[model samples]
Target: MSTRAPDRFHVSSAVVLCTPGAADRLVETLAEMPNVEVHAAEQGKIIIVIEGKSSGEMGATLAAISSLPDVMAANMVFEHAENLEEGLINGHRTDAA
Candidate 1:
């Protein structure tokens, strides 16, 4: 018999650069995507956070963002992965003995 590991949760943050005039519209568009959250926008720069089940999923989203109109660049700044089966208690991880 084979057992599969629990799904891993991925979190990533990116900085997107866009035309100053397009900031508002771009923010609205990005905010509508699943697992994407627009954190801040100012002077043509946008900060966003994304959550997904895997690195591929997050990379796909980043690619999509980079392809959007008026987006000059979407650079991933940070990433974190958490194993779902890791001694989690009430959504927080506990040290194992």
Candidate 2:
């Protein structure tokens, strides 16, 4: 039996670049995953969020989606709390008058 519990899933964000005319197909494929969610899209880019039990599982899912012929790249934009907190804290400073 495994003694370690799976890593808890939370909010994750990534930017995916799709091949020409492949956004629809890419979104469709991503939609198939149980916890994967496509939040936004533009010209040839897609913004997605995923909830998984572990980093490995999330990576596997992202890899699967990115490996699709229509996908050009799937770069993670945000995936952890520390990243967000730092950005948030920096954004709101006492100088913002």
Residue 50 of model 2 has an lDDT of: 75
TM-score of each: 0.86, 0.70
Q: List the residue pairs that clash in candidate 2.
A: none
TM-score of 1: 0.86
Candidate 2: which stretches are off by over 4 Å? 1-7, 81-97
Q: Pick the candidate with the highest TM-score.
A: 1
For candidate 2, write residues 32-89 as lDDT tens digits. Answer: 8788899988899999997766667778878887787878898877775332233234
The TM-score measured for candidate 2 stands at 0.70
> Per-residue lDDT for 18-95 in model 1, tens only?
986999999999999999999999999999999999999999999999999999999999999987778765555569
At residue 19, give the lDDT of candidate 2: 84
lDDT of each: 0.93, 0.74
Error of 2 at 45 (Å): 0.1
